[model samples]
Target: MGQLSKIEWTEATWNPAVGCTKMSPACQNCYAEAMSHRLKAMGVNGYADGFKLTLLPERLADPMQRKRSTIYFVNPMNDLFHERIPASHIRQVFDVMKKAPQHAFQVLTKRADKGEGFVASYDASHHPYLAL
Candidate 1:
């Protein structure tokens, strides 16, 4: 499972959704794209389609189940603001984050404008930043 991550900066990985499509030249060397293939080769759950941009609603409650405070790297395998990821789903992700206030989520996305607009609908003062 991706519940715990080996990434040095974060305590754990919360991939409520996984998989993505290459959008630009920078995607050729994407760590996530590489990892997606690796995880797929290893038969990891949630990566059956490799990098096809699939969403996993079942994983949304992952943080709520944990009692310990954590720093989560949200969607390390995909962008939270990807064109295909709907605002309702993002709302669900935020709702889970809201419920699990003990944890801090780090959400990184190339679409900062969309991310900002999405976060505007909610009280996002305590949540993740779209840009670094």
Candidate 2:
């Protein structure tokens, strides 16, 4: 009864936040959007607003307790670099990932501009995969 997920390169998914708007044809049938609405109707606390960008700070620490070295899809249900998400919150997420080195986090975003901005501000020591 926690976060819902599908298989990917990662061992599992972690949706610290949920909901998103479509920005491209690739998003025509966003799985996040569909999942959000379903979870909303099911009365999931965070999805009460259904697809509106909301931060879930409570879920931030979930990765730290895991014993396995996992590849975590940073957020399958939402985009971490959405414009609506503040930089401070993004930093918090990154901080968690940095602390939990046992888990490899993968984040995908359709908002390339916002993604670029996030990359520009990220600490290179913690995130060497960043490219401008």
Candidate 3:
């Protein structure tokens, strides 16, 4: 997760948390998991847990720190709406996105049911750009 990204859909990627369990056959070739293993082997701090559902609180405020406006692919490496992530933590992530409107936060979760439930309860007025 950094200010610059090669992903065509967005300008940058921000991982408030990383790592996820395989949800389906599509996840068999998970680039994130493979990369996390490599990062863990290389001693990169965040991947220490190596594809486990690990949250990085320090990275939460990353977008707010950058002066330039950007399109942030939030949690591109992991499912933010994964069952393992707490409701409060999900709210916290949304809260950060709400506070930083200069940036557009895109969240795509394989857990559509959980994602829908969260969205139904979340105040859309507060987070206009937090697209699920």
Give each prediction's root-mean-square deviation over alpha carbons: 2.4, 2.4, 1.5
For residues 19-109, could you state the per-residue lDDT of candidate 3 as single tens digits?
Answer: 9999888888998999889989999989889999899888998898876789888898799998899998888888888888788888888
lDDT of 2 by residue, 1-132 (tens): 123345755577777788777778999888889989999999988899999888888988988888678878887889888878888988888888888877778788888788887777788696655453
Off by over 4 Å in 3: 129-131
**Cα lDDT for residue 94, candidate 3:** 87
Candidate No. with top lDDT:
3
TM-score of 3: 0.93
Question: Once model 3 is optimally superposed onto the true structure by TM-score, how far is the C-alpha of residue 111 displaced, in angstroms?
Answer: 0.4
Worst 10 residues of 3 by lDDT: 123-132
- Which candidate leads the pack in TM-score? 3
TM-score list, all predictions: 0.89, 0.87, 0.93
